[model samples]
Target: MVNNKQKDAPHAQWPEAAQTLIALMHAQGEVARLSEREQLISSLLVSVNAVLWAFNWETRQVLYVSPAYERIFGRSAGLLLADYNQWRDSIYPDDLEYAEQSLAEVLRKGAVEDREYRIIAADGQVRWLSDKCFINRQDEPGQPVIIVGIAEDITDKKHMETELQRLATTDVLTQSSNRRHFFECAHREFAEARRHGSPLAFLLLDIDDFKLINDSYGHPEGDNVLQRIAECGRGSLRRGDLFGRIGGEEFAAVFPGCAPDMAVQVAERLQQEIQRLRFNHDGQAFSITVSQGLTNLTEADESLDSLFARADAAMYEAKRQGKNRIIAA
Candidate 1:
């Protein structure tokens, strides 16, 4: 009963209205999907113990910070968000200047910057952090420059590195500096002594009858003897003294600010201490002695090697002179 024009008008408008509704729904679905994906990625970063953040360089404010900031930095996200200085104050004093300089460089170049530095947590624990930041410049006029960044807690990794370095430079048997580390330290001490014209004494020590002990009681017992000798020597030396195991049954000590007479007295006391050590292995009780050679820095000595050679020669002379005495070179 309706007019033909009127009937066609409603039908034509229906398709256009439906299409617009469908497009709106699709757009909403896409927006929701993107938000979910971003949240999932953020959760992943938190799971891996990383903090994600965005900073506004021009405004000098933190625009965004992940939840992981509370976990890693031991500071609440709300607190840091309210005041940027809360995060800045957490940085260790020594590292703050360097970090500022690095940030300045990144802003100047408008590129990525990476730095490793130390931070003090709210719990009074010192932690290491590795930070990577990328500059995001705004194309629109009057928009603030932004910095997108991530920071990771690298304290455990840093500890592992430090322990590895210690193992590399230290002797496993005596827990003293190894031969290579000994030389490295000695070279530096030698250079400084030469520059300042200071008195520096070097002493080489050898375990008396070490081979005999190894042959008599096996290597384990011989190891015990060496450890005892090292303990005695360490107890006799001062804190500033450099003592290290230079070879099997051979050790060396560097005494800075010690004269030839003081070196002789120290060597004598160390020999006495070693002689007093009583070692009991498998019901076999015995004592050991050490022979030492002493030398001092001299203008005639051109290099560490030359000085060490003279000390070695004197140590052999001690061995020749009854195997339990100290000789000066």
Candidate 2:
């Protein structure tokens, strides 16, 4: 059985699918056709994709739930006996307060608004969601008042957002963080260091003579070298460390709590790790070495551009000094 919260189920006690038809027929009568309008309103409530939470402002009893309520909520609205506060048990704990506040506001002015919240499925799965409500208020005796709302499933949109974030930050080839994301994340680390008066370090690494390997062995062999380097980088860094594929044969590492000297130690370790990488192509075994540049975060100005400039300059110095060496800036 599908739950009310599952986005596909029955929610209406009275089926009113013909009200839209009534609204279209403009009748020239002396008196108002109140029943026709009411029917149209009820059918609309049943057809909407969102949950229609309707209540009598005076009685405080829920008068209606759109047909999709069970589909989106999992629980039966009729079981609550028109007491909408029964939603307290059905709603996700984190969203209950917001829901209650919105309900209060709606009751106060019958204001129309949309809200997003996490709700529990009938089967106990948590899902992200949003709902739009259009409320109608009345303050007379022997007359019906209603609050109409539509609900839509936004879980797919939320998942898409998360996946996009991953793509933006992660390198497609090596599944490591990408260069842009590396810099973006490193800035946050730098800010924290500046706030706490801590040290931050960076290492800019490049494979030694990678073009020579590509020329002699072919691009495939060079790719193997890069992949091997990525694995080594992952193995060398600790948790909370950020390492990225900064370029074709270049990489970067951000160490949040390390001094310039310690950064040099890390750069040297990475260089040694790269030297230990062994690969075989067409039954031929070979090794590769890496040159690295190190830099420390300073209180003078903790900016991404400044740090990158220092690291890049130090990296060029390492490259100039016969490659395979570490230079600090």
Best by TM-score: 1
lDDT tens string, model 1, 235-279? 998778889999999999999888888888888889889889997
**Best model number under lDDT:** 1
lDDT of 2 by residue, 230-284 (tens): 8888988767889999898999999988877767776777778888778887888
lDDT, candidates in the order shown:
0.88, 0.78
List where candidate 1 sits over 4 angstroms from the true fold. Answer: 1-4, 57-60, 92-105, 108-114, 122-125, 139-145
RMSD of 1: 2.8
